[model samples]
Target: MASSFSASWLRGDPRALEFLSDRFRHRAARAEAVAAAASRPLAPALHEVLVARNARLAPSPARERNLELLARPGTTAVVTGQQVGLFLGPLFTVYKAASAIAAARALAEETGRPCVPVFWLQTEDHDLPEIDHCFVPRNAGGPLRVALELPDAATSRAPVAHRHLGPSITGALAALRAELSGNPHADEHLALLERAYRPEATLVEAFADVLSSLFADEGLVFLDPRDPRLAPLAAPIHRRAIEEAAAICSKLAERGQALAQAGFSEQVHIRPGAPLNFFSPGGPEGARYRLDPTSTPGTWSLVGHPEGASVTTAELLSWLEREPLRFTTSALLRPILQDTWLPTAAYVGGPGEIAYFAQLAPLYAHAGLPMPLVVPRARFRVIDDRARRLLDKLGLSPDDANAPRDELLARLAARDAGEAFETPEAVEARLVSAFASELARLGERMAAIDPTFAQAISRTDKTVRRGVSRLAARYGRSITQRDQTTLERVERLRAYLAPDGAPQERIHALPYYASRLGSHAFLRLVREACEPFSGNLKDLKP
Candidate 1:
């Protein structure tokens, strides 16, 4: 097996993530400018929840302790996500939350702004299957795979499944603590985490409960949109969002038709006319949907019915007009809210999150929101002692990590030996030529010994070729080892970008987030490539 991979392996996709990372490295100044004006109340409701949750099991309660120090007026809210696990994925799931908290603290120190980071638990996300897995470092002794422990009579309806949250999470955390031998207070940490995520709470609230431990001492307020008081502030946004979503849905129908005509089996849906997301009144009871009847099938609700009463486009628009504030908070209202929140100085996001944010810029402007400045989350490329030692042994540079492993190995080997061997193809060709020459010489000698000499010579030639083939393969494998080491490292890093795998690499995932970091990154290098395309917003065809 080959060892190394290069940025080239991502093909010529300008939107490839690897390329975007390279480009974004130069845009640090722009990001700083955007982070300048953002502000929030120090002791936001969200931060308090985080502290309380963390305090439950924590021996010292650092998260809660930190919240007490910084809980005050004039703080900036830092937000991020976690996949219901401690192990962050290739996309830096844990780091996203950590960075937000860290950056908030750092920013608070610098700007004199009390910064508190909030971890938004995506409980409404229906991809139950995706959140079930967690990665453990090799030294941690392999990855842990866990599944939801749904009850026998558990219906898709809220109450049955709602009860599953606390146990499943507690059980999973316990299992993880048990697996890690000799880790100090593993049980305590897990217990503290359990206090953070409560079954009766909203996904956002549950998220606050667990993540609060990380920043509770900062006096962070854990605001749950599920909180009835906050509901009023967000409700208008929610209702309008749903109404706006109806229009977006109409646009999507037209776009889908065009995609179908273009011979696409699966459409790249942007919800062009639809809003990005909406807040619901209660968990499951106030469920939000992208469209009443999704173009894609199998969209039955928990009770086996469509989400809302099917209404004509005109009727939906009228409903939005009647309760503009309420519908504004629906998926229909997303584009408008984004527009309302516009001139957004900076939006902290992971690479994929950035890409989806980019997609909304045009829609935001169309909906009258200012185009916000985009910033990648604090990034990390982990290099442990083993990784460092391996790099040193190979005498490879950080830049070399971006090169094709096989090529880098060949180069390294040639440098070490002061000479290089022929390519595998060339070596194979030489072997074939040598076998032919030997067979010719043997054929004449064989004819002198017997009449069946030609057959004998043919057999001899086959034997010689087989021997060369075997020898060549053995040599190839040995050479591949050098490249394999590098390849493994690159793949490991790639894993963080997408734990499940890259969006395009997957069967049905969206390139929305991946494209955000990658495409935006590549834009710097290949601005000229796309400059020919006008700024005109081309209407998606019906």
Candidate 2:
């Protein structure tokens, strides 16, 4: 049996719940608007670009078929994407892809339209540290965060797509293998990871290769925006962003403010006068920089690089026309660009993505593009036999695993103590009540004797309460010490349920589960467990 819970969003954001519930009255209007916007026929050149990119990737038969489907005249896609992370990042990456695949299938069935699932690889992001590490459970005990350190050449402000795993990746792989050796499928799991994270492979290629291997049979098409072939297709969107730099900034700022006013903080901060495009000039020495509106009316200045230069709108437009691959969309504008290039029917996203879309709605409206239906991806926490047995032994649910460590430990210790130990709360409450009654009587007697005696009584009352609190603390310590086995059990459970005090899916990488439960079994569990747009955290018993 499996247990589940609703996803807890940042600052208790209700937008995801509302979106999932169809509570927003304007949802129909938004859908209609998106439908109209997507009704335009896709360009022939765009199809050629996708075909060319697909050919370069050497996609699986299923993926190649899906790419072919995407080239059809009226075909729209269901899209979801994430930054390329180590070993495919956390489990949510797989969940996100699964959700997109399921959503695409469902949408095609309902609309009688060709819809393909596309996982856009966000390889243009330059934050290397964010994707450098992944957590895996140590064979000894607890979880270990393993990272492949980058050399100076690969550590520049260049996008991750251009970065390669150097010699150091072998050590990272060795460490990962050591951790997984306890599992029966360790050899197979390590082989897959090694094949993907080869020393000579770039991060983007590695991510695409591993993801392609995992979801190839499911026909999930992987798109790398940095592909030179798609540069011309994305040029128009980049041109619009550069030309209307000020207007786009203004619209984004206005929308961000609206989102904040609606009690949701903006996910992507819109800096005043900042263009929603990252510019990377051609050449090996070129570094990525953010574009900002210049003092001149229609010019934009490159910021974040010491040698950054200003470009007139005409110059920027010319550069985009010539080399669109040099420009990348910012987080806020990526969705709009995606919709502009691909006929996106729906976008499957996580909680944060869903909240951020609220801010992008205005951007979509401003761009004359329809905001696709933002569907929250299904979230899952895999529980193997070990975790399940521990949970059952503790007689706890998955939600109980989220309790604070100390609180959970105390609860378990108390239960193990049976009727022998009284909880600190009960003891403190009883003591306070008894002390209150006695203090009241003492206060009456002291007042009768003399006013000074009242002060003494108050001091004595404070002393007694402090003594009681100290005693309670001592008792709790004693109980905790006496039940060492219970404490250990709690610790073990914590590691399994909330390692590093976070959900397993957020902390452990996919290889951890794939090793414990064979890769095929793990993938099958995820596919069977995931319920697209279900809007609930799935508890999977594998």
Candidate 3:
């Protein structure tokens, strides 16, 4: 799960760590101190929106108490969120929430002040393809992609809140039923999904329902940014963003450059003449539109239209008053908006998110918001018992399983019963070396007779090397194909631990494990596995 940027920051590349507020600490004492001093009044509208949402869900005394604390004065939040993915998208989604909950608990204990966990629902995101699928593990030991296929769903630009799960969900469920046919927990979990993801429920609603069910006892508040009531609370920030739009864009570009100089790459692209926000027309079908500055003073052009309409700044500000939810922050601006309005002690993020924060690090000061501690979420390289046994039988490490399917199988097959699987590689190396030496001697002799003949010698040498490599690869594959036992073990090992060369936590869904462990046990394991403030990924049973 580590990107070059994330590995730099998380593994303590000192230059990379400089972008953060604090580092090298296993406790939230310093962050708690900052949050204690950074007291701000709650966004008046959010309390009602959050409390109402929580009331509609299953009863959890712990969650109920967290909700109460969130409404009280001087309560700080430890927030993390994801796009409303089907069945909670990837496993990291759960890891993110667990990290936030862990950070919140540490903060409350450290400061003796109220702190609560909040999961912001990114319902405004319009990329349907990103959230339409969930990977279920098969009985034979591999991933099964259970996706809802709606032709319109793929082509539409509408936000997830508008994507009603209609009849297409039945197809996805049927596919899931087939995958989980022999699973014992299938009846209970599928029934839970059927109830949550009904024909009438929007994608966001179903995601919230399932996620809330899992974390019912954990008290993670789900906040919808599109809630009409909260628009007024966000108005001042929106206005300031519009008025100082160019300046903010300039600051972001400069920060992106600074990140590059520090040996890191920018995660969010900063465009010239574009501000840190998007404009939606405020309807179920309206797509999120990008706004660009016009040459005329205080006028702007909406980028989505083929023929852009020039609207004055006054007109844009009016939308904030009448339909303020029309305006939402960009990837970089969202942290500012969240931290400014909510008393955030820390923000739990994965590698990519943390890398983005580095690009927008200085923007907090530009927006006049108190920067929250950006904590790297605890990571796991999940492996089941079956995968463990295969790895041992093949004498391969967990890291070795991350290679591509054919290459990894080739490696394991080479170590199988006979030298047949490895003979081609030895033959290839010897042939290439001998051919290169002969080619060099031939080239020298030809150069003495005619300088042009040296080029032919070089070309022949290159062709010979390429042909041998392909033959060796094909030979190894053929050998592996003949050994059905090795093939099966390699498939089982790679499929469970590193599907498509990514960790299981990233490729598989919560139910992939929960179906095996049961909800209560899975949740308990997640809570216990959360190594808050410890910037490291470790092996765990759950």
Candidate 4:
């Protein structure tokens, strides 16, 4: 949620978020953005890239209409994206899309202009390890991490888009088969995964197909920046980033100073002369090399590969013109490329993006690009009906179940023992309280009869109290043992809802829940739970 935590990204600054959050201010920005967008004009062929890509992945009438809406001069976009992740990566990927759709719908209503939700499929990123694996929830222990153990994956250093699923996928699929329930929904999801993640399917194809299977019908449009057609349109921005490397880097450093002054750190730190770009000399299967300026003016060298030749500014631009798809933006400049090509009114992102966007205000101003409104993706902890029932029976709320394993178990033990039988603490308290009162009356009588006998009464009371405490302690284990089903139920709740002591949404993948709860349940739950800009982590029982 954009609560105070998001404000910390800007700390002393609230103007931009405030402006976008307010209807009156948003209308003004929308009008201004429309005019500015008209003046700059994106290439006309942008829609063609989306249409062709979706035709292959997942296409629907709603998605086609949204693409048409986005192609128009006045229509704006609500954009969010992540790398083509394995099995949809974490649940926040789903959350990011849901929030974008909600924001797009809200922005359309508020601005009275057509708006579409666009998920930028980051097919160009070469971070294979980051998107190589995903966690699967188990009924016992916790979530199991299933990774495609392709032997070449580590050494390739190539983009996942270039890496096709290998025979190792069989083992990963086998893990899924062993772990997931044999219900009808589980069988269908398994079939879908098998179809999508075959040995020949590129990671990009598999990721796109599975995600499309889930959300394409909702009119969420996909844009792969790696599309060769988009390379030329984005080349200018890439050129500017490279051509003005020194000035841009200088401006970024100054912006870092400003952010530091405002209680934040620079999200991206390019060394003094490194441009905010990467060069992939080897093309699709090749490793991406960082673009850093050589000591000589107008000349640059690839940072990692020693054998790669240095190129002058003119040569790089010429190369970029010929093969723009070979170059891509660093995290800091990705939003610039996205907003430049699309009529983006607002961009929904998670916490990390929010922090980095704060560092980009100066960069955007330097590039003369209007910074889109940044909204935090909706956060949630999806609780199933089973977890809900367990929470109810154990007298522990979902929040309590989210506690650390040991702490939650201890509380559950105390609670279950107290209710079903009696915890040692409870028994001791009861025995002490019961005897203290009678002891006080008897002691008073003895003291009145003989003042010397008062000491004996006190000693006797102490002895009785000690004996009660000992007895309670000696039987505490037996009391906990009598918990029967309560402890097991609590463990099940922990494994599902708070695996590894983390929120389920952060730990478990969509496949885990989709198998148990149908995919439709996810679509409906996300749609219903979203409160446009509320930005809260809510609990929803599906």
Candidate 5:
């Protein structure tokens, strides 16, 4: 089906178009040119670690089959990832997974090679505030942002994966249940959430459990980098980053400068003498610190806590070998580590990721890994019957919903005033034209007589125009007050379209829709509606 949505932003965003076609040129290459680049298959030991991780999550038959496929000689993965979020974060999370699956299936069909879809759970991310909250509209109006917070006693700068949901999750779930109580599938959605977000469950486990249940049949594999078993596999990449810290830093600095010169901002900055890897000062339970080189050659200290301890190059290597899990790649180096661990054919991400990849072309080359084809994930805007009726009542298109609340209301009020109210605007335009012509004739006559007199005529014309503009503003305000009901309808439409001045997909939680539409039905709607490599915003109607 054709998408019901339109995104004018896509027309002008060069990065979005670049990701869609996988080319700097307008046209894409043929099938043969698009063939997957050969990379070494996953080693048996690494494959076992992946399988064990999936087994812990209660893998489906399809996931098991995909895990088996990973062991094959030529199989490569089409990968995407996000932070473990509340109720799977925003709708874009689902869209990203669907995009990866679509891209993988298309690649498999085109090349006749096994290409599996994988979602790397960003369990190592320590930023708790980012994933702690999700927005859900209560009663189809303004959104309520529900936050699941860690307790003061338990709070630390540790990775979110290790943080338990705790008692606060109960209140958060209750809030969601109350908001979603009226729908037929409300119980089912709440049950799924409760099961995944139990008080004792860690954030990473909850995210995996929920996603596996949602997309089990699609054969999407989930990978957690924090899985201790995979730490050994990541050791080589980690070591190289530390050993070549100075060179990597220099390269990143040069590339960041080049990007700025080219009129694009660098997403990740390079800190001089800082290692591309983060070092956990207190081991697994401690906060992570950036490794910075010390004044002594071949020695380094943590960026913020330099007085804590200094490690020579030899000592750093020993620490990596003994405690591989303690070392994590910086944002700039994470993609390199991902490609190292998985034979990735393409890495699917949003627009911001695509821009950063432009800066990392040099780093990919330095790592001796081919830069995977970067593809834009699908974008969606979900619309229920209530929102549809509101749009129709307001004489607004889906695209019109993007306007600010005040702007949309003003436009609606003007339309409600009809042509009778607009007659004054027409008359004002004619008056302005007549006055312009008369002033020009007067100015010509005055200039012919005395050059300075023309300046006086111009000033008089400006004063007259200012008076007319003020009068027009007053007329518009009066018309708007007369059509106050239309303004109220526009307000309701704005709530659905752009809550808090942001798109619905960026704000609303997944369960909000699961309640409006049945859970299974909503999943099917997203899966079937998404098109491979189509970056346009889709409007999903229920």
Candidate 6:
């Protein structure tokens, strides 16, 4: 396999292009050229927004407890969380959350924030079906890929005890290892993974334990959204939401005919109102919520029990008016539950999360909540040390890595050609001489047709100039490709940097946390983002 290049060299010649087939230029040269082009300062608006938003928001009471734990002398926390499918599959995912915890403590120490990390279980997300399983790379020992697996009804909601998780998780690890044919250390890696998979603990617990030692001083706190205390906090909101949802269903049913004609889905855009389901810190349910899928399907079902035989939009509105308390409770309680415990100042998330938070900005405003500033998550493309060495040889950068394979190779050939050609002035002078001679000949031919054909002769002269220029350009492709690797690289980079085109698919799978940076790196980055950013839900990337 060909080796890759490192960032240092790639930055050197941002616009260098090469043809690998030519063998004169290694791929690294192109990479270095591209990286040089891509690296630039972040937009001013983004930076200002981040600093501004980080200044506001705090955590709920439960989170406050965790925060206080970190505040204690020499204590820390490892933290991470996911939208929903976080717990579905893959051992690397566990690492990502744990890594976030490790990163938080590291940053905390550097900044003297005494930060501890914690994982927030997104149990309430109604999109439970999405987080079923994980896929790893097809190659056994190399990269990672994801495949989806559905959770059984019981394990789906209730916090999965460690006993229920360990064996099955181990099976997954073994399968992953078996798939990786040439993994030299597959056995050892599997052993490490097996130890990390804690079946007796819930998903949050298992993740925390996996990273336990990383934050030995600034320890990890695990929070399951299903915890009894938290559930009830969401109860009033949940109840009111369910009731209002029924009404929404009723309205949808009534409008079904019209909506179908308009080609719209049954999705509703919820806005907080009258029956504020806000709960206080001391709610009886202690802010606990069960991970039941019914909350969602119930809202959509066409027929059901007491809430109504069938729901209408008006009924949904009535339920909202009836149970304002429940809805507000969840929002008010989140800060107390998580942020109050950590000294969080920012939230980092992917694009979707960022957009979702943006959508909820008005709700936060209405509830007297401070919206957190959102920052895009750290993205990485892993290339091993060998690739780095190869990059060094070719003097390339990551940005140059994606150009057409043929073009890259062609660059190498051009570099080897190394022969300097005549300058533009010389070529222009030759063209001028040739054009003058051709025009004179054309004039003679026109004169032979008629002495008064001067206009036709003039037009023929202009046409000859245009045609010669076109022919010259046609003959110059190979010459240009040979002479200017930098220009070639620039052209290739432009293809990718186009505003409308996405050169590669972004990885959003839960396991991305682990596979990209390993568990420790993943956890720390996420926790740092979530703790501070959660307060400003508007800041979370969609």
Model 3: lDDT equals 0.77
Q: How many clashing residue pairs appear in each of the predictions shown?
A: 68, 0, 0, 1, 0, 128
- Give the whole-model CA lDDT for all candidates, comma-separated: 0.41, 0.76, 0.77, 0.75, 0.77, 0.39
After TM-score superposition, the amount by which residue 462's alpha carbon in candidate 4 deviates from its true location, in angstroms, is 35
Clashes of 2: 0
Our model 4 lands, by Cα RMSD against the true structure, at: 8.9
For candidate 2, which ten residues in a row score worst on lDDT?
1-10
How much lDDT does candidate 6 score? 0.39
lDDT of 1: 0.41
Indicate which candidate wins on TM-score: 3
Taking all chains together, the TM-score of candidate 5 against the true structure is 0.85
The residue-by-residue lDDT of candidate 5 on 1-542, one tens digit each, is 21111121245445333323354122143233234343568779878888888887745898999999999888888899998888899878888888888888887886778889999998877788788889887544577888886654334557676778888999999999888888889999889889899889988888899888888888889988888888888889889998888888888888777655544566677789677888776786577777788889998887665367767888878878998888777777889989888888788887667666766777887998877776678888887887898888877898897876545655666566665556345546877889999989888777777989977887898998888877766765666566656766666676777777787777778998888787778888888887776677788898
Task: Show where candidate 6 strays beyond 4 Å.
Answer: 1-80, 83-115, 126-171, 179-189, 196-208, 211-217, 239-344, 373-376, 389-395, 402-542
Give the Cα-based TM-score of candidate 1 against the true structure: 0.54
Please write out the lDDT profile of model 4 over residues 1-542, one tens digit for every residue.
12332555333345434322322134576555544544444457888788788888765788888877766777788889988777888898889999999988887886677778889888767777778788986666667998888665655655566778888788888888788866457887888788898888888888888887777667888888877778888888988888778888888788777655555556567578788888777774577777778778888888767586776888778779788877878898888888888877778887677767766777788888877777678889877776777777777777887776544554567664556655566778998998999888887788768888878878998899889978886666555455657667767888877776776777778887778877777667888899776667888777
- Model 3 per-residue lDDT tens digits across residues 1-542: 32377777766777877776454263545555445435785765777777887787767788889888877787888889888888788988988888889988887777778888989888777788989998976646568888887787665656676788878899888887777656667777777888898888988889888888888888888887776667777778788888888887888888877777777677888877676777776443476677788788777788766556556788888777787877877778788778776888788888778877887766888876666778888787666666678788888888888887777777666666556556566768987888889888878777878988977887887888899999887886786687688778778877877787787778888776766667667767778988778857776654
The residue-by-residue lDDT of candidate 1 on 167-259, one tens digit each, is 565665555555543443444444544565445443344444444443344343333323233333444454444456556555455544543
lDDT per residue, candidate 6, 1-542, as tens digits? 21121111122223111200111123343233223212322233322332232222222343344444443444433335563332334332343443454445444544443444555555433333454344443211223443223345333322222113434555555555566434444454344445555445444444434434333433444455444434333443445434454443334344433333433222223332212232222223222132111343433322212233333335444444454332232332343233323333333344344333433433343333334322233333333343344444545664555544434444544454555544333454588678788778877887877887788767877787677666555434445555455444434332322111332213233333244344445345445544321122211121
Q: Specify the poorest-scoring 10-residue window by lDDT in model 3.
A: 21-30
Q: How much is the lDDT of residue 360 in candidate 6?
A: 40
lDDT value, residue 108 of candidate 1? 52
Task: Order the candidates by TM-score, highest first.
Answer: 3, 5, 2, 4, 1, 6
Cα misplacement distance, residue 467 of candidate 1 (Å): 18
Off by over 4 Å in 1: 1-78, 82-91, 102-118, 140-142, 150-163, 166-171, 184-191, 194-207, 217-221, 245-268, 272-288, 292-345, 366-368, 386-542
Indicate the residue-level lDDT of 491 in model 5.
61
Question: 3 or 5, which is superior by TM-score?
Answer: 3
After aligning candidate 2 to the native by TM-score, how far in Å is the CA of 56 from where it should be? Answer: 4.7
Which ranges in model 5 have alpha carbons more than 4 Å from their true place? 1-21, 24-38, 151-156, 294-296, 299-301, 304-314, 420-484
TM-score of candidate 4 against the unseen true structure = 0.81
